[model samples]
Target chain A: MSYIAWIISIGNELLIGKTVNTNAAWLARKLTLLGYDVRRIITVPDNEEDEVEVFRDAIKRGVRVVISTGGLGPTFDDKTSEYLAKALNRKYVINDEALKLVIETFKLKGLELTEPRLKQAKMPEGAKPLPNPVGTAPGIWVEEDNTIIIALPGVPAEMMGIFENYVEPKLREIGPKLHFIERSITVKGVPEADLAPIIEKGMKMSNRVYIKSHPKGHEIRSPLVEIHVYVSSEDVRKAEDEINKVLDFLIFAVKEKGGEVLST
Target chain B: MSYIAWIISIGNELLIGKTVNTNAAWLARKLTLLGYDVRRIITVPDNEEDEVEVFRDAIKRGVRVVISTGGLGPTFDDKTSEYLAKALNRKYVINDEALKLVIETFKLKGLELTEPRLKQAKMPEGAKPLPNPVGTAPGIWVEEDNTIIIALPGVPAEMMGIFENYVEPKLREIGPKLHFIERSITVKGVPEADLAPIIEKGMKMSNRVYIKSHPKGHEIRSPLVEIHVYVSSEDVRKAEDEINKVLDFLIFAVKEKGGEVLST
Candidate 1:
């Protein structure tokens, strides 16, 4: 069976359009590459009630892993840890491991461990701390009702650092491993509508693969449309072969239309 | 009262990391500038049941406006229009206005109205067709259960064309209008941790203003940490004043910290 994951991006900046939410895309890509199916990405504000509701709802929706970014900072608006505890009906307390991470990070940065900073250590009972090397906030990882909840800091750099150093390895050990192979061909000058027939025909070449065309731009300086072919399976070789078959047909169609493949 | 919106971006490519979901960010920015709160941005695959569930659930959550982008093509995977109809319990039919748009678009492109292409006219009953000037698939606009559900084509150019030319004007007539004033102050040669104190102090200048510092990088060549100051109010001047007060203190602090404000 395949593993399903969901992302909940918690930040008012995202809802207000102050931030573009590059974190969801980054997490989705990482999870997908690691053989997990990232099914849904939901962005909510930093409100405590809404955060608790969304986090609980994701679990109710039957996702195996749920990752939330943002709302892990020292500011007043950051309340993911507190809300998450309430969502799962767990006790909220200052975990010593998480507190150590908070204290060490502040010491390394030559900053005092203020009360606001110390609040980052308060997490749900029985949750493990995912150390944040680049920032003061420590991420939380808890498993409940057969669902794994992972919360990362909102800052993109800190989020990426914690995921790469801690979460990725942990997920690799526990999450399902499926093989995914994707290929792309860049075609210039042909609009997506005009290539609909060719794309349809290319898709008929492989039932195990999906072929999608993304229109980049039609401007004179950037006349390129990218066709992506994706295949995933339990067997790496089968996935690779399926993707290759779809890509071969797509590349041939692009070349037949007098278009150039910028990348293979 | 401000109107809340939710975006449902349907496509496996977005989940698989093949696409960056620029449409959600674009729509969120537009709605926020026009005085709407985009509470949730959800990304799901092109599955019919999943789409229906998400659409129905968003309305249940009390968002007045729900917009979905993608899966409006003539391809096999294009099922958003059909699923949206099921979600609202509306009958599916070939809308006359939508059919005209599909025929005219294909006629102009010198393409035949093939059976698959004709499917673009199938829309929910009683829904108004938002003409797609850029593509064959026309967008659908429907009012159901006190919520407005809009479905746009997946292609960025086509989605944008319909949103700007049609839906935007219609929304202006119905959706709430809130003024959002956002100002930016970029400081060089200072880390976010070092500037957190100043940011906290600047925030006290105005309770109506919000100041967020985003660390770009710490290296000498890329030492720009952008501080965004935001204010939203019914009065345009009030919003402007609030943002300016926070930005003034922020800029002065940056200068005192041996940094520069590259932008106001």
Candidate 2:
């Protein structure tokens, strides 16, 4: 199973630069660590048309999982659930389970639910509501054919809470069981431009392992670069050994080019 | 003159959770402040097929300007310039100006140019190379019909240098001349759910001004919210006055709802 995923972050704030979209990065890290190939991280505005377009685009690409954050609030601009339903050609209605969760949450705070509060319970029909232990709006989880669609609140705490509590477990069950291994080493005294050919040779030699170099110092003087070596395989020991062998080869090659390995 | 812009960040490191995409956020902020309506921020791997597909999609969407970062280096994985040429149906060739820039940069450091270093000079036909003051790769700039396409190196310093020194001036000449004004006021003792109706009312009252509420405190207990009021208009005074009026109304309405304004 190819366990591919896409993160669709919906918010005008993100588009306008009011927010830095730490949410997307956080979710990307989590999905990658879970052995899913997170292929795209997309951000669009809160507009319903843009939201629907991005969602449909993800579906057309045939990714295994689609996760969206933001716009699941109570304001008029909060339209992720409704637009997602539109994109899926499903009915947008208040889920009874979601309503119950909202009522219980508000009741615990000694408050009564209102129309604005009721908006938190609305979701696409036939979707299951993931309980938000830290916030009011319940997260949405629905499966279409082979893809799993999820919507979480924009609040970092709420998004993290629901993701860790519900989404992680479900994803683990559906995703491929692959072991991922990675290692990084910093090299100095060699410019990244000069190190490129060696990296190319290393990648060609070990097709199973991926080697990426990040330039850390000035290209002209005091050159520094961080090379990341990683691989994934069905066998844990095989993945680990492959990465180690690639690292060894790359380290030896860098030394041969008069580059100093600063740290690993 | 809608001034629509899109930011494309290319890297596998971003997808694999090895690096955070701070470049996209920084560019989004710059574009927004320059009066460009940044519609989307897309991140993809270093794969050529993905890069070509995204570039074609952006062109098809008819955005005014498309700025892409990363994959403009010398490594095998760095294919942004070549794929962008293919997407535009232009020849991928070495430009004389870019080659001169690369040669001069290396010469200043008392170093000799090699094939890997020469790779940084290749760009699409009819594209102008924006000199990279900090790195080897010269940024690519090309125009097709009504859209402008640009590609910059992934290193933050190099990207920023080329953008600020070259791209910013060109963009300023083409973008809309609009003044943007924004203000934020934090309110405590009010849950975001309860504040939603007031936000809705405020938006209706001042449709020209955009009012967004960010939940700062927990939804149920010790509730705090930051209301951001902003507007953009051709007239600087008009934009400022409009946002201030909305802020005043929102503040007064919050107080009426028993919410205390903490900071502005």
Best by TM-score: 2
Q: What TM-score, to 2 decimals, does candidate 1 have?
A: 0.90
lDDT of 1 by residue, A1-264 (tens): 448999999887787776787889899999988888989999998787789988898778778889999887665667899999999999999999998887777676566776777788999999999987776688899998878999998778889999999999988888676677887787887656556778888778777788777767742234577778787677888788777777777778777877777887
Q: TM per model?
A: 0.90, 0.98
In candidate 2, stretches whose alpha carbon ends up further than 4 angstroms from where it belongs are none
lDDT of candidate 2 over A1-264, digit per residue (tens): 558999999888888888888888889888887889999999999898899998888888788999999999988899999999999999999999999999999889888798988988988889999999898899999887778899999999999999999999988887787667889999999888888988998898777888999998887778899999888778888788788777888899999999999888
Total backbone clashes of model 1? Answer: 1
Worst 10 residues of 2 chain A by lDDT: A172-181
**DockQ of the candidate models in sequence:** 0.41, 0.77
Model 2 TM: 0.98
Chain B alone, candidate 2, TM-score of: 0.97
Pairs with steric clashes in candidate 2 = none
